[model samples]
Target: MATQSPFPFLDDLADRVGEALQPPPWFVHEAQRRIVLLVNHVLMQEPEAQSRLARHKGSVVEAHWRHFQVRVVATPAGLLDLADPAITPDLTLTMVEPSPLALARSALQGEKPQVRIAGDVQFAAEINWLVDHVRWDLEEDLARLMGDAPAHFLAQGARGMADALRRFAGAAPGRPPAPPSGTAR
Candidate 1:
């Protein structure tokens, strides 16, 4: 029932800053390139995901959020690469939540943000499958660098922190909900 954000001024300032501080075109382009590379690396670890993507080889998927857009095309190798700017995307997904804080709050509470989908339905289905089924094994990746025990310890700490954040965001993990801001006994 509370209609106010915990940090109202910061939230408003962030929204304004986000609107006014759009990154340069080259910076956005380079960020998109790195994102594609990371995505390909994750996809490479899952053969089933790769096979599903490979079935749609050359299909383009473009995602838009605010002023940022990333267009990637499925490659024959079952990986993704940045698509040419001119190639019309076979599928386009636009995130409906405009506020960064709102989106993060939804994510921390284990909810998916709303998306507006357009273009190929089958391609969208494949992408949805990828989202639901594929997960990066963070502990495994960390263990490769720092050995098993430390990696597991770090992962557990992270999970505990995430759970704390989820609780702070109004999730009930067998605990009472946090009191509303500006309220005290």
Candidate 2:
């Protein structure tokens, strides 16, 4: 017969704690992955236009397009032939002036949406860059938000940008601009 030490449980507990001390892989990527769905959900609901006063409305009904700029390159090669448009975001967050005390009270009450408190101040440029660069499966992207995906694929906005660019370039004042410098070949 063998006798075990009374300290055996302590050793098991220490080993379990050591394993738990190692960070979970999900913790590393959760925020990164969540951002895609979060941004998509927010932008999809953004309003086309808003009055200056609309910014002040705190109701869930409030929505506004955080403006995004994509550069236009005038060339004769047709709009589809254009390269990536330079993305510059110009979003100015204009929220309603709040009662400082009221805001403080709400803060204490934890009623404010986490998005606002999280400093998710809509960065239009980053979104545009992501939309342009990532060859997104739009269906998948949407589905991911709807909790339908096994994984997420980034969405591509370049197609839409190219469409818009083509319209702009066609109307630009120039002699078709010789198909841009590098693109001539």
Candidate 3:
């Protein structure tokens, strides 16, 4: 049986609103710059990730999600730098799924979104390794800003909220409910 969304009109409305609120080119450029910086910061934290990337120095990688895209080139220092549009990317990754709602659902369920990858096999393998192994310790970062106790409390609260939402969403029709938070597998 095919299921229909309870509020199909809202989906159309959202699409219109998103189209009307497209960011200006300058704002997009700045946002992309910040994203690259953040990605580099995380990559720097893992020496193995940096070394892997360094091996592909000068190779360009472009990532696309919907209408937004960012191209980066591997640096000799095992870091990434925003790439000029003139440079042809050695690897391109395009998100196969475009709906934000679907993407969010997948994320909450701890699954990776479908992505179409093309180009150098070695570079792709390195990227996959980084994705599978590297993660930013948000709690540690928060502790540096706000004391350890507060950071720990905040993380716990966030985790609880996330778990609650996951449970609620997964309990809906056609979805399997998630295991209760903190329960033994």
Q: Which whole-number lDDT from 0 to 100 does residue 168 have in model 3?
A: 63
lDDT of 1 at 167: 64
TM values, all candidates: 0.86, 0.19, 0.86
Global lDDT of each model? 0.86, 0.35, 0.84
Q: Counting only residues 3 or more apart in sequence or on different chains, how many pairs clash (N, Cα, C under 3 Å) in candidate 3? A: 0
- What is candidate 3's TM-score against the reference? 0.86
Whole-model lDDT, model 1: 0.86
Clashing pairs in 1: none
Q: Which pairs of residues have clashing backbones in candidate 3?
A: none
lDDT of 2 at 168: 43
Worst 10 residues of 3 by lDDT: 1-10
* Residue range 6-114, candidate 1, lDDT tens digits: 4568768987888899898898888988988888878988999999999999999999987678899999988999999899999999998766776788788888778
Candidate 1 vs candidate 2: the lDDT winner is 1
- lDDT string for model 3 (112-163, tens) is 8788999998999998998899898888889999999999999999988998
